[model samples]
Target: MNQNQEIRNQLIKLLEGGIAYQPIEELLKDITADEAGKSISHLPYTIWQLLEHMRITLYDILEFCQNPDYQYLKWPDDYWPKEVAPADQETLDKCIAEIKTGIQTMIKLVQDPANDLFKTFSHGEGQTLMREALLVAEHTAYHTGEVIVLRRLLGTWE
Candidate 1:
């Protein structure tokens, strides 16, 4: 495989493994009593909040990749949805599933040979398809790390 394909494959593995290995269920299994709902000292976001935020961010990136005319937005400070808080195991699982689907869709889009990897699309200044693909990987991995940290703090890592 060429450099771009190699990078894309590596990223897919990283993201897939990150989500697969995460103890999301354990962490949110009993969030009300698990202390996961409580704020941590160093991190500003809770495990639940981070998952939701990451999902939204990845979805936005995918949207931009799929639709060049889509307007991208900054990560809002008040971005969490009040109605769908990750307060329970079921909601957390749903969020994970959604994120996994988004990641898969992004990978599929990038893997399409007909799609121009170097074609510029509308992002802040405009980014090539390859650049956007790499950005998705980078962004997902970063947030996945944060999720791992939160899991650790909640004593859910396994």
Candidate 2:
């Protein structure tokens, strides 16, 4: 395959949780709201918070990449969930859907040859498509690992 195809595959792999660590699917499966809310000693954020943060940040980056007029949420404040616990099962399902949708969008963007991966966005900051894709992948991987660790601490990891 060509370079763009190769890059697209790698990005998809990151979202699918196949390479580098456990898949988000595997990590998140069967986790109850209570389980997601529990925090180990000294851990600031719960699994719910982490999942919401991941969804928020992924949308922010994806919007920035897609829209020139995109407005970012305030750092730290807007990126994380205000509550440590999940509202309900419906909320959890929504967050997961949004994250998955954002990942699919990013994958399509990366796969499209018409879009210049290296071309920088002409907005507040000079960010390129390639840079943003890699950023989301790295960020997701980091938090996914954190979630795994938190699960182990909570005695929830299988």
Candidate 3:
């Protein structure tokens, strides 16, 4: 593999998680909508909020990567979920499905040699494909860890 392919591989690994942290897949497994909404009184967010936020933010970054006509999403407000949790099992399942698809989409982006990984977007402020991928990885890992803490508190992680 050339340097770029090597970098792409590394980026894919980062996006997949499970290195020095729990994979989102593992953390998210067995989580129910009810359990996702259960918030510790002192905590500002529930697990569902975190998962939804991750889905939204990752989608935003993926759009930014490909879309020249991308519009800015209002920060904090647009990035977060209005609902504390999914309304039902189907809703939660859909959220998880979208999250996984977004990850795969990002991986496909990275794997494409036509996309210069280090090339900054013309619409972005010094943001490159690599930077956006890393951002997704970092952001997902941070929130995934929080979910783990929550599950432990809920005594749900098996």
Among the numbered candidates, top TM-score falls to 3
Backbone clash pairs for candidate 1 read none
Q: Ranking under TM-score, best-scoring first?
A: 3, 2, 1
What lDDT score is found at residue 21 in candidate 3? 68
What is the descending lDDT order? 3, 2, 1
Superposed Cα deviation of residue 87, candidate 2 (Å): 0.9
Query: How well does each candidate superpose onto the true structure, as a TM-score?
Result: 0.74, 0.92, 0.96
Give the C-alpha lDDT of model 2: 0.83
Q: Provide the overall lDDT of each model, using Cα atoms, as 2-decimal numbers.
A: 0.66, 0.83, 0.89
Candidate number with greatest lDDT = 3
- Across 32-109, the per-residue lDDT of candidate 2 in tens digits comes to 888888877898899999989999999899889888898878988989988998888888878877877887888888
lDDT per residue, candidate 3, 39-131, as tens digits?
887999999999999899999999999998889999889999989888998888898889989998999999999999999899988999999
Clash-forming residue pairs, model 3:
none
